[model samples]
Target: MSSDVAGIYARESPYLDRYVQVGIAQGRVISLSFPETPDEGAESEHDMLDRIESYLDGVEESFDDVQVALTVPTDQRQVLEAVREIPYGQDSSVAQIARVTPGLDDENDDDLRAIREALTENPAPILIPDHRIRDGPGSTPPAVVDKLRSIEGL
Candidate 1:
């Protein structure tokens, strides 16, 4: 809780070594990471750790569905919005996501590749829930993507 601290607060699984690292600033979560290895700022004190711990209303559930503010390119916002509509435990391909997207400069069926590009550039993967994307559209690291899918039982 000290402004001087520049670190992440972790919330670990009670029976497993796995954990989630939450990063917050100005009342918004800037990042959420579930990794086998800690990321750059993987240290914290009790106050911040307490906040992270409170997010777990369900011990086995993944809170990746939560939305947060992200600084994405103006054009990519539509793509992200489309992606956010994907139901949990389900998925949509890049082409499918693009087909539903509005305000795209070009909504051609051939824009699958471009849609894929926009998804990979996501700054906040879990909050954006990019892992719900299928067939390699929007993406996160393969390992973490697997973790997301497994956690959601997709």
Candidate 2:
């Protein structure tokens, strides 16, 4: 976590039917959450928020340009980076992700497990778009995944 930060922000999301919260540091997204209640006095205006709103509205927005600060281990980070490459409104299987992930033996079951674990531990859901994964939603709520996929018309 950088010392310089814009602080956490929150906004009610009609698509998810929850309050979306984000923690930002040095202009990079560090955390994301869907809370039942909004944080008091939390800032509600951010470029990311607008992007998410637009995406939920079926704009086919791409989050590839968004800067995200990840603190996972090297292997998981590599897997996550590959997951991020899954284009908007599209999906990839865990095997496919493992194949594209750097330093991984796609034929190995352990590598496939690693990909699943990385996605399950994803720090930012929509920013990373783990819902675009085909097999499952990792740790993201299944309903959220369904909603996201529905919005994407997938």
TM-score of every candidate = 0.66, 0.91
Candidate 1's displacement at residue 33, Å, is 3.6
What TM-score would you give candidate 1 relative to the actual structure?
A: 0.66
Q: Count of backbone clashes for each model? A: 0, 0
Candidate 2's C-alpha runs over 4 A off are: 1-5
Candidate-wise lDDT, in order: 0.62, 0.82
Worst 10 residues of 2 by lDDT: 1-10
Model 1 worst lDDT run, 10 consecutive residues: 54-63
Residues 8-112, candidate 1: write the lDDT tens digits.
666664422466666766555566666666666666453544533542332343444444556677667778777766766677777677668874434464566
What's the alpha carbon RMSD for model 2? 2.9
Residue pairs in collision within model 2: none
Q: For candidate 2, what is the lDDT? A: 0.82
Check candidate 1 and list the clashing pairs: none
lDDT of 1 at 29: 59
Over 5-91, each residue of candidate 2 has an lDDT whose tens digit, in order, gives 578888898778887888888888888878878778778887777777888788888788788899999898898898888888788
